[model samples]
Target: MTQWPISDAVEEMPPGLWIRRGAPPPMFSMHRHDDVEINLVLEGQLHYLFGGEPLTIRAGEIAVFWAAQPHGLIDSRTGDMCWVHVPFSMVLSWGLPEAQTAPLLSAQPLITHAPELAARIAHTAERWGEEVGGSDPGGTADAADGPADEDGAEIALLEIQAALRRILRASSRARPEAPADGGGSVPAARLRQVSDMAQFARDHHRSALTIADVAAAVHLTPSHAMTVFRRTAGVTLGEYVTMCRVAEAQRLLLTTSMRVTEIAEAAGFGSLSSFYQHVSAACGMTPREYRRQAR
Candidate 1:
């Protein structure tokens, strides 16, 4: 099987929620994080390789998913995307009914077809963007004064709860089936090994990593680790490492004033040539161009 990289989407943030508005990122490889994620498409379509199945969310739609499942944005024709990341703990605290939370827990993305709700979401996203001082492509929204401020945090939580309830109402007649497994139904032990390896890569992507290091982290031999990761994640361990590095590079490029060379080093690239090669291949543009367009 061909090895594809998987980016990791874990970062420290304010306790309950994180929200951002911007262009959809370049096609990301399969990855999983611990948050429950919502995507509100304002003006274009998003195509996802979600749990190994094809799903397309068009303009004027909102989709929520359990981000712990392997998923990626393989394609997007959208320039305006609003993403809200609510921690699982926060979701649990919302006291939503079983029917409302069951599908997401089971990995089924609850998509609402309410155009009015989409507009409301977009407005909330704009307010959030302003609250955080505009689009934060790197997901770090003013760490000094983020949503943790009591008033802003409370408003965001209330807005999210209302939005979710509205979605539950809209989806009553069209609830989707549980999402299919993304990793070809592997054994639980193998899944844990792969998850561990993926998390390790995410945690240490800023440093040089090797297959042997990742294998040791998961207490498996290199070859056996590779086999398990491939069978369960549909990607090789090496590719996943590269994906994490490239993703960090993209984030720095779009969100910081750091020079390209600096970003390359900070993102764990061994050489400027490799950094340029990977960035161009992933984003279809040079880092400078990407930054300029993103701004």
Candidate 2:
């Protein structure tokens, strides 16, 4: 079978957020990550197939959505963008009002129309980029500061919280008409099955797993599970499993000093040859090379 296109996992960075500045690539397949994603479009626009529904964010707009849902960027007219990934745990810790949190959790992106906030967003992105690039020694200093001045991490959290509030206010005031296509035609039961199976695979990818095992987790037969997952997710069970393993391997390679062989075994590869083959195919580089380039 042809391999399915799986989205790469977003690694968690310090301060419980990952920030990047770039244009989003067109996604060949739907992908999900365990983070709350915020996108600030600096130029052009972004088109997304989010949960089988079409959504668009124009230039200068900030859109925030839960990354756990199956979302894909099928097209874009944007040349520049800033992406922020906040861990779900951090989002919860922010204690956002239910009005803002409910929509995000329900797969509804809270889009802001307040152009006034654009400069602040840009500055935040710039500061984060500097910190990640190691241009500022005091970048993480806020993390160690007391409650008064706060650390950089604490300041970031507060800024994000304030942004959410502003977004919530903007959404309420605008009351934009809902999109014509609310979502796709996939039945809820089928979606639940596929989501359950995918969650299972993500949770257990470090251990030995199989299609049958995934099916059993959702109490479905192997054939039924395969059909439902493919229909809803557009990926085969085995392909999804491989994607999970490869993603874990990538994380380990970038963040840890563990030996390649150890990382291979830890990421659920049965043999070194198999690990090398999968990592090379997915990343276009051997493990050592990937680590070097990533670092």
> Residue by residue across 56-87, what tens digits does model 2's lDDT show?
88887888876765566756774677677776
Q: Give lDDT per model, in order.
A: 0.67, 0.65
Model 1 CA deviation exceeding 4 Å by range: 1-16, 129-145, 173-295
**In order, what is each prediction's RMSD in angstroms?**
11.3, 12.5
In model 2, which runs have C-alpha deviations exceeding 4 angstroms? 1-16, 25-28, 131-150, 176-295
Question: Model 2 TM-score?
Answer: 0.48
Best candidate per TM-score, number?
A: 1
Q: Please, what is the TM-score per model?
A: 0.51, 0.48
